[model samples]
Target chain A: LAKTTQPISMDSYEGQEVNITCSHNNIATNDYITWYQQFPSQGPRFIIQGYKTKVTNEVASLFIPADRKSSTLSLPRVSLSDTAVYYCLVAKGSNYQLIWGAGTKLIIKP
Target chain B: SQTIHQWPATLVQPVGSPLSLECTVEGTSNPNLYWYRQAAGRGLQLLFYSVGIGQISSEVPQNLSASRPQDRQFILSSKKLLLSDSGFYLCAWSSRTEGPYNEQFFGPGTRLTVL
Candidate 1:
């Protein structure tokens, strides 16, 4: 598992987009970047994943630079319920363990 | 569709007491199961993982142990509970296919409080 770094916290307004960036300078070729969203008293939920370039889902978009040293998770039109901790991870294989960072707590205010 | 289920939404145990938490996956076979603990204000710590029935791997050396008696069934147990063992426990599983890169699906976590 490759180590990842992310902001500790962020704030956003309702109906606004929130972008959380993560840095994994030592990421490996086989490693893929993945993100999870966790709310208080609940399990972490899968957000998006990408190896390179970009990946998008109904909920969020993941953008990876050509260098692949960093990535960003973009959440569109965040609502109050979007307030949660976001985790960034890098894995090489199925058995590849996940190393979680402190996570970025996004508080969506009205 | 596959779903993971965990028991005892919350537990409060006394020091020196034994502990056991169970997790089972439905609608899936030969899946990889994992146990993770999340402490307040911190990231989740991987406790154990199982690849097959009766196969278990411990990421952190501690009093807690994990077992897989059957496919899709994973258990976390401790002979003597420690205060530090208190935290949010999460169960997750991923398909064995896709060669280890499959995204993991998590179950609602169990909150443990040790007295």
Candidate 2:
């Protein structure tokens, strides 16, 4: 398991773009970067995942530098509904447990 | 098309009472099941995980235990509840076929309050 560090919280307004970065300096070669979103009183939902470079989905985009030391989650045209905690994790294949940090509390203001 | 279910959306039990929380998954077989606990204002803590029936791995040593009786059914149990056990419990499943790169699907979760 690779330890991740992220901002404790972030604030943004509607229609704005929000970017959260996570640092995993000790990331291993087999480790992949994954992101999850968690709303209040609900289970965390998968947002995006990537091994390197960039990967985009219907919801968000993940960008990883060549060094793979850190990654960023970019959300476009955010709304109030986007308010949630964002978790960035680096994990190897199936057997190892995931180490979750406190996560970034993203508050999308009206 | 896969879905996960957790029972007793909310529970309140007195100290020293027995506790059982069940989680079941549909549309998937041989899935890896996990139990996680989140304290108020904290991140998730992995408690236990099972890759197959009759096999379980515990990440932390504490008062709780887990069981996997069926391929997609996982259970979290404790013989006697303690106040410290009060927290939000979540159940998650991932496809073993996807190997280590699989993304986990989480259930709605169970909120337990031990007084």
Candidate 3:
């Protein structure tokens, strides 16, 4: 399990792009970066995952640098409903243990 | 699509009372199941995980215990509840085929308040 650090909270307005960065300085070679979004009283939902470089889905994009020491979760055209807590995790390929941090609270203001 | 179900969306238990929370997954087999607890305004804490029937791993040493009676059914139990146990309990499942990188599907969650 790799420890991750992220912003405690962030603020953004509607129709804006929001980028949340996570730092995992001691990331392992077998580890991959994953991001999850959790709404109030709900389970965290998977946002995006990547090994290196970039990976994009309909919801968000994950940008990983060559060093893989950090990753960024980018959400485009955010809306008020995008307000949630974002978690970044680094874990080995087959490892079942997921290390969780306090996460970043993103508030999308109207 | 796979779906995870957790019962008793909300529960209020007294201290020293027995506790049982059930989680079941549908449309999937041999999936990895996980039990997590979230204190108010805090991150999720992993309590237990099961890879197969009759197999369970405890992450933190606590009064709570977990059991996997069937492939898709995972249960969390405690002989006596504590006020510390009051929190939001979540159940998650991920595909074994995709390993750890697989996206975890989470249940709506169970809100337990121990008094």
Candidate 4:
């Protein structure tokens, strides 16, 4: 089974750039790296996704290296509202493809 | 314009009670459905998924079972609730059009508290 590893928790001040890295060495070939964010009492929300190189959207940026062993989610100038748990997700099979990271609980202080 | 809905935003039940949670999707056809559980301060745990009606695939072995009576409806049930069953339940769906590795969209989630 594929697995993803990420920092358990992180702390950052308001208006600071935050970068969360995820390690998924067993990720399937051609599988896209996905990120999700969840606030308390809510379900996970899709943040960004990428295959390789770099992809940027209004919410966040995803950077995947050549080997695809890992990926990073870069949030620009985060604020207090950005405090949430971020997860890294990937898949291998059609039936059993729910592999995901443990999540990083980001705390942004104002 | 696709959306997924899960009923009973919050529930509190005693142990040994029967349990049922409903999930439905709209604006999509023949999509993949998934049920997940998340304990406090933990990651999401995949409980069940269905590719179509009556094609449920369970990921973890527990006192829970799932059924897909309709293409867009999924249900999670338990004969007797366990104290350990208390957690936040989430329902999600993905389209095959996104390929074999589709990104899932999650519902608002239901919080269950079994005492």
Q: What is the C-alpha RMSD of each candidate to the true structure, in Å?
A: 1.5, 1.3, 1.3, 1.4
Summarize candidate 3's per-residue lDDT along A10-93 as a digit string, tens digits.
999999999999999878788778899999999999988899999999999999999998899999999999999999977666
Alpha-carbon local distance difference test for all models? 0.90, 0.91, 0.91, 0.91
Better of 1 and 3 by DockQ: 3
DockQ of each: 0.70, 0.72, 0.79, 0.63
Candidate 4 lDDT, B1-115, residue by residue in tens: 9999999999999999999999999999999999999998789999998888999888999999999999999999999999999999999999966554677889999999999
Q: C-alpha displacement of B19 in model 1, angstroms? A: 0.8
Clashes (N, CA, C under 3 Å) per candidate: 1, 2, 0, 0
For candidate 2, the docking band is: medium
On a 0 to 100 scale, what is the lDDT of residue A59 in model 4? 88
lDDT of 3 by residue, B10-114 (tens): 999999999999999999989999999999999888899888999898989999999999999999999999999999999999988766777889999999999
Residue A76 displacement (Å), model 3:
1.1
Q: For candidate 2, lDDT tens digit of each residue in A1-110?
A: 35789999999999999999999887778878899999978999999999999999999999999999999999999999999999997766645757666799999999
TM-score of chain A of each: 0.93, 0.94, 0.93, 0.94
**Model 3, residue B15: C-alpha shift (Å):** 1.1
Evaluate model 4 with DockQ and give the value.
0.63
Which of 1 and 3 is ahead in lDDT? 3
Ranked by DockQ, top first: 3, 2, 1, 4
